[model samples]
Target: MSELIIGVLGLQGAVSEHIKQIEATHCKGIIVKKPEQLHDIDGLILPGGESTTMRKLIDRYGFLEPLKQFSLQQKPIFGTCAGMVLVAKDLTDSDDVHLKLMDVRVKRNAFGRQKESFEATLQIKGFESPYTAVFIRAPYIETAGDQVAVLATYENKIVAAKQDHILVSAFHPELTSDTRFMKLFVDMVKKSKEIAAY
Candidate 1:
């Protein structure tokens, strides 16, 4: 009967936009920089930001192991853009892997450089219509594990995917005005709670 409280990893990036999206969903969104805060959140979001810098901060703040544990606990997690790269298990041509939670192989800046940033209407699974996806120096999934479900694709490239409690997008959903992806994350949180209750 308690209200849902979602946390956004506040190491860097568009944290406020995600908080606003969570607020619009009628759930609380808090910035979590410390590991202790994870205990209070029903779901967590890793927002779009510089992957390398965020990784360093996460290590400095001692959030790496805790976040890996959070993902292992089956709590809902939504990763956007660089966030997606952070969560991916495999990073092509790089030895640095952060959370390594989702079973996916990602290519950093898969869409070329910053000038190649573009937008597209993505036909995401479980959604009735397409979503306006904003790709900014995005990292797309080159390959995924058997457990990962492809959600949205752009030009035959994997742009979105889900595996168990983890959801990820190569594009920035928060950048767009639409809140469907945020809603889906909230709904995932509710469903996870319901399952836990049973």
Candidate 2:
């Protein structure tokens, strides 16, 4: 087994799906339900779900401050759907206590509600061909800073992006059978380990 350890924030959302992807990559995928759990992780994943409910859980579990600090440290993290919103610098389009990691502004429910969920073949940056993206009430990064690079786009909108070790996907890449995104994340974990050793 690989030494890379990934933490999937299990506060709420599609934790199982992300776990499946992480496991498929031959790395350890741990469900992080507590603030202490964040300490041992080499990388972290914030899954998709109701943003409001996720906030409540983060606050109720007293993880509000710790998670925020963790992201600020530039640890390798990938956020999907609502998770993307939380990790962003701010979501002026919506009202919520976001983790505020990336310098992107997210517009919540950009495609409507649950019924607005969709599937589209996206042209991801590093990927060779188009990827089947599953978006469930996803958000769109309205304003990305210069450091942020667009990883994937759908219908001329930025759906997937990365900034240093932090990645955010408006669509749920975990829901798809393709493991490219997860592989990229695993690669990121390895790179993070190498850099930390220096």
Candidate 3:
């Protein structure tokens, strides 16, 4: 099979880090700066960053509708940290939602400010061992729809989840050296491409 191409929303956040991880999985990673670039990738990674600022850039770059359409196509999306907030259908603190693609209610900065950032070992679902997770001004899922499968939690708060092609995590997987989290997303993309071929 040909190598999969994954894109990192380059408007903001850990774009290079995600690119590195995507390449680590033996896939091509591109920084998607325009709406039309979405058509070239089999999957996308919304990296960690300031959700509000990223939203502004998304609108400025005219990516809002294209991003929504990308999700509608059932191409896999992995949202990390602020990216998770962007994809959520609802926010505990605000009525405004960006993508509204994921069926979850998220609370921004649920873990406190940047100085409060810390790391924790998480027992993610489907993984055989604990994964070290880094949380920096993160958001946690307060509620998820029936279709959402809760993947992992920290302090009893939902930190990771998957609903069909949308995968999200409150922590930044790119911050850690472990590629397991990224591998999971890669697998999701592989499965999606396989299904689309038929």
Q: What's the lDDT for candidate 2? A: 0.86
Candidate 1 C-alpha lDDT tens digits along 47-112: 999999999999899999899888778999999998998998999969888888999999998887
Q: What lDDT tens digits, residue by residue, belong to model 2 across residues 52-170?
A: 88988988999889887776666789988988988888786766647777889888888776548789888888889989989888789888999999988776778999999898899
In candidate 2, stretches whose alpha carbon ends up further than 4 angstroms from where it belongs are 95-97, 113-115
Residue 134 CA displacement from its true place in model 2, Å: 0.5
User: How well does candidate 3 match the true structure in TM-score terms?
Assistant: 0.98
Best-to-worst order by lDDT is 3, 1, 2
In candidate 3, position 17 carries an lDDT of 93
**Each model's backbone clash number:** 0, 0, 0
CA lDDT of every candidate: 0.91, 0.86, 0.95
lDDT (tens digit, per residue) of candidate 3 on 91-160: 9999889999989999999987653598999999999999999989889999999999999999899999
Inter-residue clash pairs, candidate 1? none
Residue 41 miss distance in model 2 (angstroms): 0.9
Off by over 4 Å in 3: none
